[model samples]
Target: MTIQKIIRLLGRFFRPISLKWRLVWRLVVLQVILLTLMIFILLGGLTIAGVIPDNYEGRAIDVIRNTITKDGSGNLMLKQGPLLAELRKEVPNLWFIAKDEHGHELSEGTVPPEFKHITEALDYIGDARFVAEPGGSRTTATVQWAEDTAAGKVQIFTGAQGEFHIMALVSVTPELFLEIILPVGGVMAVATLLVIPLVVRSAFRGLRQAAVLAERIDIDERGVRLPVERIPSEIAPLVRAVNGALDRLDKGYERHKRFLIDAAHELRTPVAILNTRITSLPPTPERARLLQDTARLSTLTDQLLDIQRLGRQAQQFTRFDLVAVARGVVVDLAPMAFAAGYEMSFEPARGELFANGDRTAVERAITNLVQNAIEHGGNAGRITIAVNSPATIEVSDEGDGVPAAEREKIFEPFYRLRPRGHGAGLGLNLVHEIMQIHGGRIELAGSDRKGACFRLVFAQA
Candidate 1:
């Protein structure tokens, strides 16, 4: 592979995928890298500790001894075979002299003249390696004692050196790999792999806790912050910065919520007084239009206050009777319904069907639905308010049922299917939020009355 491709492959192995797997793969790569250094250290340590002799030529001498046997003449001689042929190739100026204690002697290659007749003196030498002697062209020499079946108690002398041939040792000896490299390195790596996951899980437990805290942060959930305790020093800075940003955002949100509350509270008084003046005016078409506008203003202020209070009020929910809640909305808005030439009716449930919610928020939700029905109910058919079984308060109007295309956006804030210009469009969105806080929902239930239906379903207490 190209260098870039190989680097990318290595990077992919260590990239931030899963924390557990990333740590495992990186440590495994490290173990592999340390194996090479360990091999060098082990070989060097053994040599320093004198476990391996300075003049160790057992590898070369064993080759020579294995090649000795008798010819058909029953005299000791070195057999010419592939191993002997290979040894000749390794040591180009090869030579050996072998003789048993019984005095049968043999020699091979260009032996130094001084050592040519020295095989008879081999009775006392056990094993020895020597550098080139004086006036000698040979670089090294070694002597080994071996006992063979055909040639008994033979002492061999040869011209081979103690230099290590790594490839040759690996090719001839299996124990170097089978015993040392694999056993030591493999055991260390396996034990490391077994223990790493548990260590990683413990180290990252704090991060998981911070993630849990982050998930709980929402617009309605004020003052939530991710903790940095027990997090790694490298990652703790990021958590602290996130908590700071959340604090700034929470401050801005609180300011915005307070402004809306103050503005809506300020407008309520003027809107109520304007509605009173319009109701007191002479009966003119213009007076009717003025009253309608005044009522729309009052409805807008109520919805604004409802939105700000939703979070606080939802926490204070209690078991309240749905019959009482739904009947109250119809009674409160009966006069406005009559002024618009409409019949307002409340079909209470059989008994006091209880629901779990903030009663004021529930009352405001019913009020928004009633206002929505009056605005779009086409100024005909009765505006029906009913408390149904399983804790449902349904407000369905008698206008041209919301068009199939517009039904989806009807509940969206500031969305108007027809530009009748009576609402700021916060009514339905406020209702939807209030229902969400109560773990309830508003659904569209269409009917044959050629008008739209809105069903507010609450959890039965």
Candidate 2:
């Protein structure tokens, strides 16, 4: 092969997917290949054992039977002495034995050593083969019976001609190497090579997901979310964490943009009032009234800015003690509550009560709920604030209840249930936004002439 092609092949074989899975894939593939090779070797050994006969005494038995069988007159004789000698010359490694019907040895030559047992066994009965590696020559022997039918029931010591044959076994070593070991080893090597790549390729699929995510991501793109659903369960948590971080980043950017827009809008009222006062006649009552209006507008703008900042800070955390913050907010707003001719009451929690939230943001959220109660509450109306654990903040007012149709819509931004001249509609809407940002929620409870109750729920911390 060309040097370039060889280099490329080497690169493909050696390079791993990623640091973590690369080692894992290598280990898995190595185990599979090693197991396969071990099985192959075991099968090879069994096959060789089968091919090289464990016992070859049967061939020697056949030779004895063919030579010692009776003729027409039932006389047992060497079928041909010359032929027997030639056979002996041909199979140099064999051992032979001959015996008559009376159990007398007629002839014996080159008999395998273990066949001595066969000779002793023949004294009692029939023909048999025996495995005998005499003097460690590694051979087998066969012994067969011969009878003189013409001399029925022969007396003791009568000699009968008979023949015994032994055939030496051929060495099977060369064939075993070619037919078993070499071929099995080659097949095992090929199988191991093929399987390693497939295993490595399968494991690398997860790494490919991370790579694809990194490739597709763009800083400007808030619309795209990582596909945590498609990731493997083992990696799903990491994907979720990354998606969560991205979600926070997107929310932060949105908050920054909204802060700019809302600040401009809130500042416009005061700036416009100041502009009108400056353009009016000097030291007049109208100018004084305009300046006074400007101050109120400025205060409102400051509160709106504080609300925005507070909500932004709360957006990232899903944990805080809502009861504690609520208590603080109630005390802070006590003076305003008294001036509004509203009786405000709060039940202090006996134990730690928690909500998923930002403390400042949740405080502002409670402030809005109470303010809405005060503004809509009739003269001498009572407002109650209470905290119920595992998550609940209730604000109720003894004033006109919200209409059924307007209850849901009241939380929408800039959508006031009252007339167009009513105060900023963002009060409850901001509360809704705060709850959403903290991963909690706000809902309007049932109301009658007894008044409206709004409940804020914080999820388990």
Candidate 3:
């Protein structure tokens, strides 16, 4: 495949994995590559410098024997040669000194001031060698060894009876650091890098749980909280702040619900009294108009109360025939449709369509849809309530269809296409809320006929 297509395919394959895990894996892969490169560079440098021979110990002994000789005076000395001069030029930071069996300096070279006491330097180097090779004997001659010292790094070679001895001290210069210390440090750093992602993932486990809890929360889950313990200190403040905001919202929502309930209760008594008084009045057109207005006002107040009640209470879902409920609502409102000069019809689905929802709320939602159709269906036109399989109810009117722009806004509280006199505008909003509580939705659908269609979709029982 093409490069771009291959990349796209890879992206799709990895997309199901969470971002955190993807990032962690990427970091691990990068660290592995960097560590491999570092190790390669370190090995290449040591090989080029002749520090890591095929047999390091044997090569060291060979080099020492070749460089040192016993003079006629029985003193150890470095032989003069092009090889020695070349070695000195290549590693200028290094010092070579030969010492007798008594640890007296014999070779011609300046040791660092720190090692002016030859016996102490020997003791220090011997101690370092013992640590590196614990079972090796220090008194053995013809032995060659390398060790770190206070002055730098030293390689020592000795002959029997101190017939000849040689010390090669390599200073801790920048080049030496690159040759030894940098490689060792890089290996340690790579080990640390390999472990970091695991540590980070472990630390973020609690935060991930908090995120999941937050995702499940909505208006209904007002007092729910994310776990605080085990959460990292860096993220604890944000969780606390979110919980505090939820607390404030719950209190404010409770107050709004209380106001709606109280207002509805207070208005019910006056509206009842007004109805009674209106019935006793002399029959007249004006009296009839006032009664109609009062009835509309009472309906509006009841809808507001239903909105608050639904918000405060949880759904009591049970399996019930949705077609039956739709038929009943249509029957109840059929007379109202006739009175308003509209033809109301219920087209029931052929088979039983059971759904899981509160029956009362479902009936109420259907009632609102029918009433809305009657109000807006225009004089003497048909309003159809159709119940279909999987528990779907569609209510359509033979009036002017809702404009595309106004359909969404029509569901908002107190929103109307016309003026305030047409409706208090809580009917559709209450219907929407009830459907939402049922885990269903009410959608404005396109009607094949010349009218508006509203679909109420419900989950199958």
Candidate 4:
């Protein structure tokens, strides 16, 4: 299929679709929100990791200063490695680098080559006897130790005139990255992964129920409502709105049905009176007049009944021969055509002119259509009725065609195409009702010829 065709097909599926689509959009929104939150959290963690190491190293450097002492010759001495060794106790995993006045290495520990630059940078700023520069992989931090023998660390030992330079690099181990951050991230990811689907599933559960309920509700079954109690609290208001709409539809259907029944009942009295008066009269001019009125009244009554019945039986239809049904109605109404001084023709539709519909109802609907044409259509015109295919039926009258603008309104109840002096205008309305019941629609064709053509197209199952 072409892209346009595919889009049209999908558009049909999405058109007026209810809660499920909204829920799907909501799920996407939630995923975006969760992802944003995760990004913020990871950035915060990295920042904290950077800050903690600097604080830890500063404290370690302070402890190292306090650990060394001065000799009688004013030369610095390690009274005991205890002060330096205490780092192994304080921060169990430690790396240290110390230098004397001549830029000589005094001690080496667990600090990696990556950390050396950081230590030198630190010393340049502190103007201390020793400087520490840090280096490592981009994600990991390391410190490099350098001595500022003239200042900070060396100046602090001026009391004894001893030159002492010590620097250290201390870092949380790779184990800390594994144990702390990895496990935390893993836990968060697993929790998020597990909860997100459930949250999304739970969020959409009400929409699913709404969809199922909507599917079960046909035009005939308007009163059915979805259960609101089991739905999530957040969706309850929406459910209530849907149920309210269904309630209104049910009420409207009932009102329309009652109105049709009442109208049909009221019309039946005048029709019955006309028939009785016709039978009572002697075989004279009065009797003929009564009979003609009775026939017209009877036809009007049948059309009204057909309209009512179409509405009531809308839900009940089965596969049937549409051509056979149309043909039968044409034969039945043929006599009326002859009496009206018009010619009636039926085009025998080829192949299986089968449609899913009520056979009796289709016949009655067609009969009303044909009879209307014969009555209102000019005396010399031809009335043609045909079931052209499994999906379509056409009825055309070669009289002055209905005006283009009025064609659609002609299907409305009691809307006459001609002036008020003509036949009762219920024929097209009744046809419209019947077509609606059969899940089909009727259209007024634009013909170049001077005639009106009505086409009924049934929807495919």
The TM-score obtained by model 1 is 0.74
Error of 1 at 76 (Å): 6.2
Q: Model 2 — which ten-residue stretch has the worst lDDT?
A: 153-162
User: Please, what are the lDDT tens digits per residue for candidate 1 over residues 234-315?
Assistant: 8999999998999899889989999999999999999998888788989999999998788778878887887887784455
Best by lDDT: 1
TM-score of 3: 0.65
Ranking by lDDT: 1, 3, 4, 2
Determine which window of 10 residues in candidate 3 has minimal summed lDDT: 159-168
Off by over 4 Å in 2: 1-320, 349-351, 420-422
Residue-pair clashes, model 1? 0
Q: Against the true structure, what is each candidate's TM-score?
A: 0.74, 0.42, 0.65, 0.57
Summed over model 2, clashes come to 2
- Pitting candidate 1 against candidate 2, the one with the higher TM-score is 1
Tell me the spans in candidate 3 whose CA falls farther than 4 Å from its real position: 1-194, 311-315, 447-449
- Please provide, for model 3 over 276-326, each residue's C-alpha lDDT reduced to its tens digit, 9 standing for 90 to 100: 899899999989988988898799889988888784244556788988888
Q: What would the per-residue lDDT of candidate 4 be over residues 1-461, giving only the tens digit for each residue?
A: 89999999999987984455455556555655565456445544654544322343555555545654445655455546765566555555555555444343334345445444555554444333333333531223323332433322431211011111112121443554466646665565666566666776877677787789889888655668988866888878988998898899889987987887788789888889768867886799878876877776776776777666665454677888777887888888888788888888888668457777788877767776777677667877789987775578788888888876886688888777666434577888877877877778888788586777778888754
Give candidate 4 regions above 4 Å deviation. 1-146, 149-198, 208-221, 227-230, 248-252, 278-300, 311-320, 350-354, 458-461
Each candidate: what lDDT? 0.78, 0.63, 0.70, 0.64
